[model samples]
Target: MADSAPEVPAEERQEDPDVVDRKAEVLAEQIKKSKHFIVFTGAGISTSAGIPDFRGTEGVWTLMAQGRQRPSAVNTLQAVPTATHMALVELQNRGILKYLVSQNCDALHRKSGILPDRISELHGNNNREYYFRAVASYEKTVHDHRTGRKCVRCGGDLLDSIVNFGEYLPAEPLRLARNHAKKTDLCLVLGSSLTVPPASGIPETVGTRKAAKLVICNLQETPLDGLVDQRIYSKADELMTRVMAKLDIPIPQFILRRRLIVQMETTGGSRHQLKICGVDVDGTPMTFLRSIKLDQYCRRAACIEPFTISFRSDLDIGTELKLELEFMGNYGEPNLEIIYSYTGEAGTEMMYLLEYNPQTGEWKTERQESQSVDEDKKPTRRGR
Candidate 1:
């Protein structure tokens, strides 16, 4: 391969250890001095999460600069939070970080456990689908075939909220960023090369007053390098980990319990035998069952999803089937960075026992107590 090719190497662009540690100390001191620390982020911070940073040697921009084609991008939907992403989450919990202004639309921050009230997404979120009923932070996706991916209620296409290259930044995020920047004492920027657009101007909103300092941590020199109070030439995760260690703070662990639904539609099966299917939260497969339990009269395979079970019975078409369903599960191991990416801090575990009476055609929901830790089971997840 040519030296100019995007795949040139893993060794050519590594960070210098001495420089990384020295830069980390400066930011740690600033973090110690500041009462309010706001954060600004871009695509660079997400590199460790299997997403390419935009301006590094092999980044999207760097490759484009060399007149080379960008590599096949990772599926943004499958992208999870990096170590740096969870480090910020810990800062927020400690109250060291005040607010966030983000340029990337990967939704890792929110998925990393940052709340909508504290952070602003200047660009739109990839996971979000726009509709009239959609709220500001997160939206529950409802599947609709009539309009084909449209909002179930509004009959409008569920638009991916990401703003294109030339599109304007969303007003609410911009406004929140400006408001927070005005009083920020320290602005710690992560991974952003600060080149893009109107979103790039947000950190500048912090005026000269209040002695607001801009501390940027990026591998590459950004356009606003001259304006920064201090520049840390290191990867975000490395520096963030060092800073957290200096502060004697530990990165928070994530514990997640996602909900998936299972529905059945019987078709050509024998009247005595029945078939059931499972579906997940995002409505991927037609039948995605989390767990199944049945009596001696019936059999079930608890190990797999999208599996079919056959049972011989003398029941009518509209008979009420007795079954036990498992609903919640755990996610995100920050140490490994595979499978689950980020877990929420709320940290809850419980199941809702649901009963539907076929004769009455009425549905009822019953609350179940949180399962004992010993009884807790890891659920099988479908999406990447």
Candidate 2:
């Protein structure tokens, strides 16, 4: 689909290290002085993570345009967040970056620990699925945008959120990005060629402001190169690493943290149904676990979702039930186990927080009791 767009020359250029350091110092000062700072990202920021860019010399689109085979690369799920992504998270955590607008659908920003409310993904995320009114994560490989799942509440079909060629950009993310662009005093463009519109027009909106300062950091020539206050031809990771150091902020490491909800429902007598599934921070279904096995019993649930195992066990309360969890292993996570004591209580639920550090090859799990509340009751909104 990227080949459908006009072919631009994929010439890459890099500035000297000293020049990049000087520019980073100036950018650091700009961020410190600005009241509202925002960032816009493109595919270039993700190339360091084994993902291919669309306009680079060996980019996917460039190869397709030349009638060459697309380069073999890791799947988006397996790609880790780059230094640029981690730096942005640190900037947001320090309250320096007000908002983020990304054209990439890789979902790296979210995976980097940026809150969902702090970013607007205009092109949609490949890892996300949308029903008529709800959005959820789709961890498996998506084909034709059909996730083969339906909305639990309304039974509507769920479609992958990736925006294809000629499709309109998401309205909400686009509107929020434009609003941030209008309000930002300092606009930082990272890894974007500024070729696609009306997403590309967002940076122009800020550049046209009289008091706003726009900076572009990309190896390729962008249409906005002439309009920016500062232009640095460098990789996003290199530039961002230097900028963060200048600001005295350390880039945080990427940790794969997941929340799983384990619930046991008493069907009747000694029979019970045990269910285990992964969920996002917002309680949306996250398909991270590939399979679940019950130890001792030698039973396993390898189905798509709603992983459940029903059995009539006369085991008394306090007896431990061990469950082996096999994850998708995108980051080399090993098989984990969860030991749950038979409560024999109806409507019992527990929450487990699983964190894995790829750099350290360590895994940690914390269990907490799940508090159940009435769904019919009106919920109270809390400030972010």
Candidate 3:
């Protein structure tokens, strides 16, 4: 008998080997017949924009979960933008992308430069802060170590501007997403493992319902694989390019710029304390370029807030000083750096620069005091 045909390599396998090509063809035909098309995206779509996936072999989430890395190392939406991101922006402009549902808190969907009214961020935006205002700044008048500040409108302690692990999902955005899924005739799932709660259920809800045809494009397989009417195992950028090409959508150019803010709060002995917050554009309150502190100048109990500081004249600098910043988690170790200059007079001012140290858990600072006999009148501390 003749030799059997040689096995095909995994790399050379058909795009959707698990299902017949005719199924996708039929779905596409249905899409053309339908009116409203919605896209439910995951982190997969952002990879083309140079943003790293969170759950792949070398992804941020996997590394952090496995103890090989830290959660703080995850990049923000603006930190990276993939080609697929630009394509989606174009789709939104063309009004073809009726609704976009995302599982990422990185805020990539919003960063694509989409209008807030058009996109629903299921997870809160990382660039902003949120908490019950009543609880955010409650101890302004109290002298206790834990009492920091009180709201002018209502007495409240300021809280960190992020969603904690045990926090409940915001309701309004979830409702909007569900409405989008219901009204959409076509649904696209991009670059998500689809394993997480709430978010994972979204794709299934859209797929099982006869209301929309499900098309999933991811680098890896998801639980929604069997439910998908169309599945493609291609990079988001590549898949988006093909989709846009077929749909005749033009891609836009992306210009990237980075802005950083630093907030230093000091509180300890003698009612001396400082609060520093800055950014290029208006954003949430908890924004900081990098967060670092040392055992010598700072300790966890010295202030009420983790990022707060107690004012000290000894921290002023007259010469260039270096600083290091580290984030929370096991991946980062102590980082070191040299500041070129730190010109300070009264030592009350700080200039901030945005930089990151992959090896540190907090920021490091150096102070140079002025030597001039009469320069003591001015307080000048540049934080970078």
Model 2, span 45-132: residue lDDT tens? 9999999998788888887777789868979898999999999998999899999999999988888888888999998887777665
Positional deviation of residue 295's Cα in model 2 after best superposition, in angstroms: 1.8
Please say which candidate is ahead in lDDT: 2 or 3.
Answer: 2
Query: TM-score order of candidates, best first?
Result: 2, 1, 3
Q: What is the C-alpha RMSD of each candidate to the true structure, in Å?
A: 12.3, 4.4, 13.2
lDDT against the true structure, each candidate: 0.60, 0.83, 0.53
Prediction 3 global C-alpha lDDT: 0.53
- Candidate 1 has an lDDT of 0.60
Local accuracy of candidate 1 as per-residue lDDT tens digits, 1-384: 133324432222336887778777778888888888899998888888778876577877567657788777667645657778888888898888889889888878876778767889887776565543333343453222122244322235445566655566778788889888888888988888676768777776653444788877777667777778877777788888888888888886532322323233223443222223332233322222355655444565354544334544333433444555543222211111001111111133234333333234333554344332221343322222
TM-score of each: 0.63, 0.89, 0.54
lDDT of 3 at 327: 28
Task: Report the Cα lDDT for residue 133, model 3.
Answer: 26
Q: What is the lDDT of residue 314 in candidate 1?
A: 36
Task: Return model 1's CA RMSD, one decimal.
Answer: 12.3
